[model samples]
Target chain A: MLATAAAAIALIFLQQAPAEDIDWDAEFGVEERERDPATGEFPVDPYEKSNANAGAEPFANGRLAAAFGGREGIRRIAERTVELSEADPRIAEIFVAHDTVRLKRTLSEQFCYLLGAGCDYTGRDMRATHDGLGIRTADLNALVENLQQAMREAGVPFAAQNRLLSKLAPMSGDVVER
Target chain B: MRTPCVATGLMLAILSAQPAHADDLEWFEGGKLVLTNGVTTIEGTSGGGIATWATIAGLEMDNGVGVSGHATIIELPDYGWQSHGVAVGIANRVELSYARQNFDTRDVGTALGLGEGYVLNQDIFAAKLRLLGDVVYGDPLLPQVSLGVEYKRSLDGDVAAAVGAARAEGLDYTLSATKLFLSRSVLVNATARLTEANQNGLLGFGSAAGAGHSLQFEGSLGYQLSRRAVIGAEVRTKPDNLGLGEDDWFDLFAAYAVTDNITVTAAYVDLGSIATFEDQRGAFLSAQVAF
Candidate 1:
C-alpha cells in the first residue's frame, strides 16, 4: 500500500511539472528596449515613425466611382457631336461645306479634351476653325442648346453636365461672335 | 436504396419544372414594382375629349402578376374640377381604371340658365395591356409600350346624347410608348389615340365620328433633375368635341418623388376651352402611393 501511494503521487507530480515549468521567456522571444531620441525614454513603441501625415488614406485603384472626364464621359461628348450635327440644319450645312471627315474627327477630339476625357485630342485649333467658318455666337449658342437638350434626353444628370460645360464655356468667346 | 434515390431525383425535377414554366411569362425572374405615369385620356372614345397628366403606380412580381392604381385631377374655370375614380392593375400586363370628371361651366352659367352651376361628370372604365414594350433591366434605352381602351358613360345620358350623339356612351383607345434615356437622364413619351369622345370626361359633346376620325398626337420630354425628381413638358393635340372650342392645349408638368412609395406631380395646364371660355390655364396636383 505504501509503495502504491508513492507511485500515484509521483505520476501526478510529473504531469503537473511539465505544464507549470514552461520557459515563458523563450516562448515570448527577447525584445530589445530602445530609448526615445528626444526624451531618452526606454521601451519605445516599435510602430512609432513620425507625426507628419499628408494627402489621403491610400486606396486600391478602380475601387471607387471613377474620376470625372473618363472614357465614358468622352464617348458621350463624341456621340453628342453627331447628334448635334444631325439635329440642327445650320450645323449640318457647316459639315457639308467643310471637309466632313476632318470636321467630324476634329470635333470628336475637341469634345474629348473639353470633357477631360482620358483621350488625346489631335485637331485644329478652335479659334482657327471658328474664324474659318465665321461661326457666330448665335449659331454656337443654338448648338449648345441642342447639346444640352440631347444630354438631358439621354439622362445625364444636370450636375455632372454643368461641371463639364463650365470648362467648355471659356472657349465660347473664341468660337462665338461678340 | 435505388428506389429512394429515384424518388429524390423525381422531386427535384418537379420543383425545377415549376420555375421553368414561370420563366416563360416575364423577362425578369423576380417581379419588381415599375412606375409609369401617362396621360389619362381613357381609351380612344369619350364625350369629354380632354385628358390630364396622370400617374399610374404599378406592382409587378415573379409570377407575371401586376397591379396598379391611377389618379388625376384637373380644375377648370368654366367647368368644375375632375378626378379619377381610380383603377387596378390585374396582372403585370392588364390595368382597369375608372375616372369621374365634373365641368362646372362657372363662367357660362348664365348662358345655359344652369346658373353658372352646370357640372358635367362622367364615369369611365378603362383597360390596358402591355403589348410589345418591356421594362428592361441593364438596358438604358427600351420603351414601355402599352395598348389600352376606355369606355365612358355620362351620368346624364339623355343630355349628353341630345348634343348630337353617335354612341350613347363613348369609347377611346390609345397606344403609348415611353422610354427613359438613362445616360441623358430624360424620359420621352409618344402617344397616338383614336376616339370620338368629346371633352374626354365632359358629357356635353358626343363622339367625334360624325365630325371625322379625329387623330390625337402627343409628345412629352422629361428631365430627371435628381434621383427622385423629374421635370417635364408635354404637347398634346385634342379634339374639339364640345363645339365650344377647336384646338386643344399644351402643358408643362413637374413631379417629385417624396419617397420610394409616394410621388407628387403638379402641372400648369392650358386647355383652350369653349368659345370665349376661361382659358383652361390652371394648376393640377396629384399624390400617388404604391405598395
Candidate 2:
C-alpha cells in the first residue's frame, strides 16, 4: 500500500512541473524579442543604447557627433582651440611638448569619435599626464568654458553639446587634484 | 659702543626670523589657514593583569601631514612589564612609524637579574601608503576610502616570539573610509584593521602559532561646534591575546583652534584590561603648532 501511495505522489509531482521551463523558447517568441524601439521616441535604456560603444572609440554616435558637426565640425573646433591656446601661454603649457595644438584639436575629434562619428582620438592617457599638477577646480571649470565657447563659435547645436558634456561630467573628480 | 652694536644686531636677527604677518589684513580672508596649536588625547581605559596604554602627541598640518610621537605601557602581572613607542606622519599619502618595546618579567627577580632586569625590548618600524581616498574632498553622499598597509618589524628575535607573537616582523594592513557630511556638520570615519599582532604588536605579537588575521572596526563621529572648535566620540576594538579580558575601548574628544598657527585637543578614554583587573582609563591632552 505504501509503495502504491509513493507512486501516486511521483505522478502528481511530474504533472506539476512547469511546461514553460521545459520549453522556454516556445513560450517567449525569440524573433519578437530583438526588435529596436520605434524612432522619434527614446528607448527604455536610452543611455545604455547610446553609450553602447563596444570598441576603441566609444563616443562616436548619437549626440557627440552632432555636437562636433561631424568631421568638418570637429576639425573646425580643433583649429579654433589651437588659435586660442596660442594666444594664452598658460593654456599652451597645459599640453605636452608638440601637443600644444594637437591636444586641443583632439578634444573635438575625440568628441566626434565618441559620438559615433567615425573619428580617432589617439590622445595620451588621462591620469598619468595630469598627476601631481595640483589642478584646481577653477582651472577645470575654465577649460570647460573655453571648450564650450569654441563649440558655440563653430555652430554646434546646444542640445548636442549638452549630451556630450554629460558623458564627460563624471571624470571631473579623477582629474582634479587640488 | 661695541656692546650696543651687538645688541642691535641681535635684535635685527630675531625680528627677521619671526614669521611675517600682514597687519593691515583682516583676521580671515582668501580662506585663512588656521594652524593647530592644540592637544588631542585618545580616551581608553588602562591597566590589568594584561594592561595596555597608548598615547600620541604632536601637530596635524593643514595639508593633512601629521607628526607625532606615540608611547604605550603594558603590564602583565605574572609576566612583568612591556612598553612600546614610535613617531609617525600622515603626509603625501604615506605614513612612516618607528617604535620600540621592552618586555621584562619582574618575578624572576635577581635570578634573571640583568637590572629590573632580563626583559626583552623590541623595536618596531612601520610604514603605510595611502592608495586612494582624500580626507579633504567629497560630497555628503559619497564616502571617501583610503587603502593603506603597515609593515612592522620587531628587532628582538626569540624574546618577542616566545610569547606567541605574530612574527619577528609582520605587516599590518588597514582600510579607512571617511565622510564629512557638511550639511549635517558631522564627520564619520570608519576603519578596518587587519592584523595578527596582539594589542597592535604592543605586547610583541598575537598568540596564533601560524598565520592569523583578525578584523577590527573603528568608527568616529565628530561635530563642528564652531569655526575653530570640534568635538567627537570614537569607539575601537582590539584582540584579546592574554586570554584574560574582553577587547573594547572608547573615547570622547574635543579640539579647539587657538590661533591660525595653534590648536589643542583633549580626550577621556576607557581601555579594558585583561582578566578582571582595574579598567585602564585616563584623561589626556595635547597641543599642536604648525608653521
Candidate 3:
C-alpha cells in the first residue's frame, strides 16, 4: 500500500511537469518559420516578424498596433519616452549629450516599425548602438521604467505595453555589456 | 583626560566610516524585481516562516549585496516562542544567517516541575550556497538548488540533560530545491534535512529513546496573489526520536512585501505536540526589513 501511494504521488508530479522545451518566442505570438533539423536554426532573421507589417497600413490586423492607436499613437509614446528618460535621474546621464530631435525621431521610427506602421527602422542594431557605453542591468532596468511610464502616459493599454515589452526583452542580450 | 579625548575621536571616526560604507552599496527599487526574492523566514533564511528555501534575501540586481533582519512571534496555547535573526546575501549567490530563539514553557513548565515560565534559548548560525538553476528564469525542468548547514547551540545544557537529551547542540544539514512556475503563478520547494534536533533544538539534540541523526523532509507551496503578496502552505516532518510523541508541523501563511525593505507575514500553525503537550495550535507573525 505504501509503495502504491508513493508511485501515485510520483505520477502526479510527473504529470504536472512543464513542457519546457517549447520555444518561448513562438509561444508569445512570434511568427513561426521552418528551422534546420540539424542545427535547429532558422534561415531568416528572427526579428523579421516584428517588422513584417512595417510600411503597411496601421492596425490592419495587429492587436498591439490597434491597442496603441496605430502609427500616431506609437509616435506619441516615443516622444514621451525620450522626455522621461531625459528627466529620470538614474538614466539622465546617458541622454545628456544625445541629439534630442534625432533620438526622438529614431525612437518613433523604431516603435512604428515594431508595430507594423508604414515606416522603416533606419537606426543601428541594438548591440552596435549600445557598444562601448558599458551599460549595466540597472541602467537597462531604469530605461525600462522610463519606457513603461511613457507608455502609460501615452494611454497605451497595459496588455499592449506588455506585448511590446516581450518583443524587446530579447534585445538585452545584445545591449547590456556590464 | 588625554585618553578620553582619544577614545572619543576614535568613536567618531568609526561612526563616520559606517555611513560611508553603506553609501557605497547600491539599493534596488521595490516591485521592479520578481516576487518571492526578499521575504524573510522565522529561521532568518530567505523563505517562508517554517520552510528554508534555496533563494537569498534582498533585492540585489546583479552583483550587488543585501542585508535583512527579522523578528517572529509564535503564540501557542501552552507556550510562547520568539525568534530574532539577521541574514546577509552576497550577490544573490551566498547567504549567511544568525538567529536566536526563545521558547517559553509557560504552564507546561509547571507540569514538569521546571517553574511556571521556564525559557529555553538556542542560537543558530547558518550559511547556504546556491548550487544551480534559477527559480524564476532558468530551465524549467531544473529547480534552483542549494546546500546549507545550521549549527545550533542550546544555552540551558543542564535542563536539556534533565529531559534525557544526549547533547546540548547539533548541526542540521539541508539540501533544498525551489521552483517558480510563472505561467501558473505558483512556487514550490522541497528540502531534505539531516538532523537530530528536538523541538527545533529547544529541548536539545537527540534523546534517550532516539539518538544520532535522522533524515527529515519539508515541502512548501505558494501562489502569488499580486506583485507584493503570496499565500502559501508548508509542511515540515520531524524525527520522532525523543519518545515525546513529536508530530509533523503544518502552517498556512500569507507574506506581504509592503516595500523593498519591509515585509510582514502572518500564519496559522499547528505544531501538534511539544514536550508531550497535545494540540499546540496558534498564530505566527513575523516582520522583516531588508535592503
Q: Name the better of 1 and 3 by TM-score.
A: 3
Best by lDDT: 3
Query: What does chain B score (TM) in every candidate?
Result: 0.76, 0.60, 0.88
Candidates in order have lDDT scores of 0.54, 0.50, 0.77
lDDT of 3 at B120: 89
Point out the higher-scoring one by lDDT: 2 or 3. Answer: 3
TM-score of model 3 vs. true structure: 0.68
Better of 2 and 3 by TM-score: 3
Model 3 C-alpha lDDT per residue in residues A1-178, reported as the tens digit of each score: 5676799999988886668798888779887666567645344334433343222223344566777778888888888888988998867888776656656766788777776666777555666557687676657767776787888777776556655654565466566685
For residues B32-113, what per-residue lDDT tens digits would candidate 3 score against the true structure?
A: 2545464666667787788889887766655577777889999999999999998877766788999999999998889988
Measured against the true two-chain complex, the DockQ scores of the candidates, in the order shown, are: 0.03, 0.01, 0.04
Q: lDDT for model 3, on a 0 to 1 scale?
A: 0.77
Please provide TM-scores, in order, for all candidate models, with all chains considered together.
Answer: 0.53, 0.44, 0.68
Candidate 2, residue A33: the lDDT equals 29
Error of 2 at A86 (Å): 28
For the record, the alpha-carbon RMSD of candidate 1 to the native fold, in angstroms, is 19.8
